[model samples]
Target: MEVPPSPTFPRALPSRSIPLAILSFLLVGVISLVILPHDFRLQEMFPSSCTNGAAASTSGQLADAATQPVVDLRVFLGVLTRPGMYERRAHLRLAYSLQPRPVRAVIDVRYVFCNLDKEEDRVLVAMEIIAHGDIVVLNCTENMDGGKTYECSPTSPTTTSARPTTDTYYRLAALADTLRDKPRDGLYHGFLNPCHQSRETQYMSGMGYIVSWDIAAWISAREELRHERGYEDSLFGWWMRKGGFKNVYGEEPRMYDYLDREMGEGVTCFRHELIADTVAVHKLKDRLKWARTLNFFNVTQGLKPSKMYDVDRLNSNMYHV
Candidate 1:
């Protein structure tokens, strides 16, 4: 029932050489991410080397993806929004924030926003900031790209020699940060596209990506790594290859891109493609689309209506409820 390792993953790199004893234990789970909170000290929390990158595979227990334990995933869900998109922001807080946590993972939601140009708007934003302590307002102008700054929020690994910078990634109190203490024995970094790239060594959807605490720490802590790659996910991948770290890419189908469309073989349904426990979905630009997606997962498990009709009860039900 083992998921065959990606061609790039099975062979060990000289830079990332591991003792076979350790390697044997490392190959347990599929693609996953484990990030810790700022309040917890990294070394003290996860003192073992296994958490650095190598982790025992959680998927090996079952041959099929459906039967596997919902591996413990702690995600710092950072939703980026602009000033005028108040409705979109509200929908995120209401739907995504309210999403019932999966039995296998823990997810925390936070919105990353930039300063508003209109001075009059501050009054309204201030109220929102007060109501929900989740908003992170950067000093820079509000724009789509400002979300990139959230990458700066993670605490870096003390083991790395990456240089530090004056940027406020450390000073921001980490409201912009995602995920908290991952499994102590292993690393679980998340990414929407857990697949091999064509021209690029790593191809990841900026929307969602996962990594062990060490990888995120390496990127967030080091000031020099800030501008290394074009996108946040790519930058992390660049460092992985450059740093001689192993890439434990998981199954790509786990993260769906087709929101309401049919894909792959003969599956048919509006959001049937988005089955239960999809790690992440990308390119959700509109508020309504987000609502629909959330409703699909929460309200309608899939388009299939069975004889026993009550979706809440079904052998195929993937949800914990």
Candidate 2:
């Protein structure tokens, strides 16, 4: 069999012109590279511009009263924390970020920490501060016996307390109700220490507590508090006593510890199973506890339905199990 003449196609670039075209393309690329900004970096070219601010939405996101209705009050809720507990802080951020904003109120959540001793923390924490704009770096050494919480007073007219793993999960609505009912100065609201001397002399437990702006300002004013050496909470109580500020409000079972079912043998007044209408739950201590606590509140209730997920099953397995 004889083959017919094959079809021929013209070349887009002739062989003679190919080298010149290649050289021109190469030159253009080189010129483009050279003409780029001297300090041109990928980060600068495609910068991640993250604006940190409270969003105004009832969709379980962090929000302030700025974009809402008339503001009745502003509460600075500072979480006393350490530089090393990054995971704990992340959990807390998620926990609070998913909470509904209190009506006519602003609950500014800030992470309060002592001086950064570690090099990694200095870098990482700085990044966090820049990213979140919700960190308070105190100028004292970190220690429970030291005046870390005391130092947080002068920083802001804020309520300083710890969070899960010494963290607290509280209902903002319940707290607002409590405060609205007792709108007065010299307010020291917390779980009263059970073994304390009397109602008049008793101190709030260290799990968590809240001091009104007046009480915090009073503590901040006393330069002598800087020299005091004792348990932070106990010292705070002593100061309350010294100042004769007797507007102490105790929330015993209302604000108690996370009750582990296995270790439910001997629960104290401040340690037991969770309850509805809770002002706060303490001793969340780990991720599992936090999961349970968050699940109890139905934090994910507003999540849009999707066939891509079986969140109910995931929740039951992840938390309930």
Q: Specify the highest-TM-score model's number.
A: 2
TM-score against native, each model:
0.54, 0.72
Residue lDDT tens for model 2, 1-321: 121242221111211111000000000000000011111122222122233333212212223233444644444454566799788778777777777767765455556667899999999998986676666676656554333333432233322222223356767667656655553444566777764456544666666565554555565566666566665556566766676554566777687877888665567666777787888887666677888888888877777767999767765655551
Question: Which residue runs of candidate 1 sit more than 4 Å off their true CA positions?
Answer: 1-34, 37-75, 104-106, 139-200, 229-232, 259-272, 300-321
lDDT of each: 0.38, 0.53
Q: Candidate 2: how many backbone clashes? A: 5
Candidate 1 structure quality by residue, lDDT tens digits, 1-321: 122333232232222222110000000111223345423322222122211110111111112222444433333333445555566666545554344334443233444445688776677776765655455454444323312332223232321112111110000111112222222222323442434444235434443444545555554455675444344455445555554445444325554454434223443221235555465554455544454565656533434767757655643534231
Q: Quote the lDDT for 104 in model 2.
A: 61
TM-score of 1: 0.54
